[model samples]
Target: EFFYENIQGGDFSQTKSFPGLSEHSSNFTLYYETDVWGARLSTVYRSDYITDGDGVSSDADEIGFHATTNVDFSAFYQVNENLKVTLEGINLTNVAEEQYNDSADRIYNVTTSGRTFYLGASYKF
Candidate 1:
């Protein structure tokens, strides 16, 4: 549900950290359910860190993630006792997955997958 740590250690040559290791990351979730209705919502978050690197150097095009967040949701409803319907969605905020040169302002690359959704039904015997 939550996490916090300072991943500050890397190759003996430097006192920094490895690639793709973000510090201070966390997750939170909420849920509700009833005899005929159920729903859930969740959010995941990660703090900024030295995301990555092409070649080990101070200005050698370092990569880092700018503290991004993602939200998702799902819900279900029971029809009678033998049928049910469901719905779900992802990336509700559409927060593009991004890459920067150390800081967030210095945008190096940007990409967005757009929001996604799904619907379905099931029957039980």
Candidate 2:
């Protein structure tokens, strides 16, 4: 259990304070791997944000949620028992647009980011 608070920035007539918003997020991760391959899984849930004062928030506080999972598929081979090679793929699920925002007491929330994938190879001697 945790908490967070934020204030906007800009000219709001008398003062430059954005709406104060708070969010709570919880997450967990699990990992599994073998000589041939390995993988990791994780997820995060964020609670809705509430506005502190009226007419102060650029975007009204709203409920938000996000999650992500990654897996790496690798193959290893030994050359003369001295050299080896491995291949990996990061962020297999490629989750995108996970964040949500409430824009001034609206019914819908805004989302941010998108899924991404990456690959690489390595050699050991």
Candidate 3:
């Protein structure tokens, strides 16, 4: 499946919306499941947006600001009718962004947790 969002900037009372504010974003997912096994994968893509109170331009008009993409994966297994196990991985590609830091006056790479994994089990009463 796919999802999308669009955000517009405007003036509300005396407060103006931020420049970047993630004007557009999309998400996609693919999943499959069976009696014994299941798997799911998802990806997120976002358009370049402005930073609030950072005085930075949108990704289209400036350097340092840019769009981003990330991916995640998950799987599960059913050992029996009453029990199951699941495994998940987040940010599998370690996607990150580079932005201009006005204070530092240089381009810096912003990173997330990189890659992480989780294992869990469930039982039915």
Q: What CA RMSD would you report for each candidate?
A: 6.2, 7.5, 8.6
* Best-fitting candidate, scored by TM-score: 1
Clashing pairs in 2: 8-18, 59-104, 60-104, 94-115, 96-114, 96-115, 97-113
TM-score of 1: 0.75
Q: Candidates 1 and 3: which is better by lDDT?
A: 1
For model 2 the local lDDT of residue 6 reads 50
Q: What's model 3's overall lDDT? A: 0.67
| lDDT minimum window of 10 residues, candidate 3 | 1-10
**Using alpha carbons, what is the TM-score of model 2?**
0.41
Ranking by lDDT: 1, 3, 2
Per-residue accuracy of model 2 over 1-125 as CA lDDT, tens digit each: 22223534434322222233334557666666665555666655444444333333465433333333333343343433444454444444454434434433344434433344444445555
The parts of candidate 2 lying over 4 Å away from their true place are 1-23, 50-104, 107-109
Q: What TM-score would candidate 3 get against the native?
A: 0.66
> Using TM-score as the measure, what is the rank order of every candidate, best first?
1, 3, 2
Q: Output candidate 2 Cα RMSD.
A: 7.5
Candidate 3, position 36, lDDT: 99
Off by over 4 Å in 3: 1-20, 53-65, 102-109
User: CA lDDT, every prediction?
Assistant: 0.73, 0.42, 0.67
lDDT of 2 at 27: 63
